[model samples]
Target: MAKPNALHTLAELAQNDTEAAARELGRLQGLRTQAENQLNQLTQYRHEYRERMQAVAAEGMTSGRWHDFSRFLDSLDHAIRQQTTALEKAEADLLAGRSRWQNNKRRVNSFDTLIARADAREEKVAARREQRTNDEYAARLARDNASRLN
Candidate 1:
């Protein structure tokens, strides 16, 4: 009776754990994909910036315009540095996310173990109840036969 209810609660808890982990995995996958895309785009931007700088150097702007060209290059250099930092941060986050996913996977296995234990307990309770019923029926039958004989 109480055993069955406790088993039911354990089963429900296991189910809830599975559901929550799946949802979290889905969300993490989406974030991971987005981060990968951003990293690729940043890499491409860096390549294009290098080519543009090379083209500007080939054009060889005049000394009168040197300061302005230098300032522009400096600005692009700063932007590249900033993008590098962002890319590193994104990689770190991706690693951390994968670690978390693995940890959650391990946690879900514990829930499965709990579910198994609950199922085993329920089976024992059910077997005991079935045996009790059989005993009661046998007693009733013996009483009836004795009365009929009398």
Candidate 2:
């Protein structure tokens, strides 16, 4: 029946939807984890640099290790900014992925209405066939009785 075929098609769509959603979710989770890790690593880096600077000042090295530390600190700041930008981009990517997942869900849900419509139509056909068969049988019985009477 058409209902069975429709159900099979819907089942296939459901499987594809699930697989796509899982992949998207995984990508979003991974991005979030990476962003959080970077944030943690970037925090307090400057304070550590300052501590190294104070030690260098006390050690009285002819070489300007302090300058190098300051430059290193500046670089770390830039790296943090870059990381923040990357994190924002990742969040946007996650949002986009989520939107796609929602669209897939909607697509699958729409098929339910289609299947219901198909089911109603098939029922009408069945009812009409049954009615016609009953009428034909009644006519045949009436003819047989009339002939016997003759």
Candidate 3:
């Protein structure tokens, strides 16, 4: 096992790395959310626009007006497709960020465990030394008292 100081240093570095990873994951999550919101808004707008176009058509619209509505709907459909693709990309990025953060966290936890074990070992050794010193002191006192009485 590594020395206590070395273990502590490693744990500190791992903690820093984990923190950076968490920050990046948070940023990725925010981006994914924004993308999803944009995609949803585009989809809703497309649906409402289509409904409006259908209602107008049912009220008897001209061919030129029909072509205009059709073209606008086509553009909306294109935009929706683009937004969907963006959302998918954002989702993928978020997943990758989450994975990175998880890995970093695992590393930090491992380092923490090692440091804890090192500390426990040190404490056990110190306790044993103290017990030995006390026992020797008691034995000497008993011997000295017996010799003085004799």
Candidate 4:
């Protein structure tokens, strides 16, 4: 049977790995949130810009001003599209990070199970040894008493 200390060390290492994985997962989630927030802000800005431009046009805007607004709106639309792509990539990364963390957690749990089983087995062996020793001592006393009686 393996030593308890060795099993304990292995379990501790597995736990550390699980913690590291969790931290990495958290970092990835934070990055994903940031990406989402950036995308939402860009979309909102584009909507507000369009509304403001429409209001200005209703006030009899010149052709040059209208052209400038159109170009700026187009750029905002392009930026929004790019941000959407970035958000999608970040989501993908977060999913992968979650998977890694789950795997690590499972590993830690398996190690814990192994340690529990080992301890149970060790206790069972020790109990059996104690019982056997007691039985031998009783037999010895019985033999000694029988010789005296004879």
Candidate 5:
């Protein structure tokens, strides 16, 4: 069995790794949130722009103005598509980060369990050794007393 100190050191290192993983997971979550917010904003803007264009058309707009609106709406649609793709990628990255954090956490837990078992084993061995020593001392004292009585 490995020494308790060594197991403790490993457990500490595992704990540090778990903390780092958690930080990375947090960063990834933030990025995913930002991407989703940006996507939502772009979608909302596009919807409002379409509504505005319809209102302008109802009020009698020139051909040039109508063409400009059409082009702008198309561009907005493209941007929305791109943003959607970006959001998907961000979500995937967040999932991977979460998985990494969970794995690191499991490693930390395993190391902690090993350390506990090692500690318990050491304590048991020490207790047995103390019992043996006390038994020997008592037996020797009994033998010496017997000799003296002889």
Candidate 6:
């Protein structure tokens, strides 16, 4: 019987690692999408606010009202900046996760290849042993026939 492959356990471990990395990549991608959506929402809100402010200004708004609007707009801008930074970080994390998954996949493939080669070698050895046994059996039969003829 062929001996069990020694690297089979390692291959299984690598496969598990690859699966974990893929899950992490998916999670990071989801976070990045959420960040992008939040940024889009903020931008839309900011545009609508500017339009409303402009209409109010045309109707001769008070100075205090103008100051308040300016302060709120500044706050919105700061939030947008922070969200942009968060989106960038999330994208970076997604890229890193993809890299990790790829590396783990490669390791799993390498181990699979090694195990296949080992199985092939064992099969070849078994085939040779079978052939040798057959040859010895044929030789014995021939010698027995020659002795009976003599």
lDDT scores of the candidates, listed in order:
0.69, 0.80, 0.91, 0.91, 0.91, 0.93
Give stretches of model 1 more than 4 Å off. Answer: 1-46, 64-67, 139-150
Question: Can you write out model 2's per-residue Cα lDDT over 23-132, one digit (the tens) per residue?
Answer: 98788979877996886688676667777788878978556666787788888888888888888888888888888888777777777667777888998999999999
Model 6 regions more than 4 Å off:
1-3
Q: Could you tell which candidate, 3 or 6, scores higher by lDDT?
A: 6
Name the TM-score of candidate 2.
0.69
lDDT of 5 by residue, 1-150 (tens): 556477788888889988999999999999999999999999999999999999989999999999999999999999999999999999999999999889989999998787778778889999999999999999999999999999
Clashing pairs in 6: none
TM-score of 3: 0.91
Query: lDDT at 31 for candidate 4?
Result: 91
> In model 5, what lDDT does residue 82 have?
95
lDDT of 6 by residue, 1-150 (tens): 335555888888999999999999999999999999999999899999999999999998999999999999999999999999999999999999999999999999999889888889989988999999999999999999999999
Return the lDDT, model 4, position 116.
82
In terms of TM-score, the best-performing candidate is: 6
Evaluated against the true structure, the overall lDDT of model 2 is 0.80
Q: 103-148, model 3: which lDDT tens digit per residue?
A: 9999999988877788789889989999999999999999999999
TM-score for every candidate vs. truth? 0.58, 0.69, 0.91, 0.89, 0.90, 0.93
Which of candidates 1 and 5 is the stronger one according to lDDT? 5
Question: Candidate 4 vs. truth: CA RMSD?
Answer: 2.0
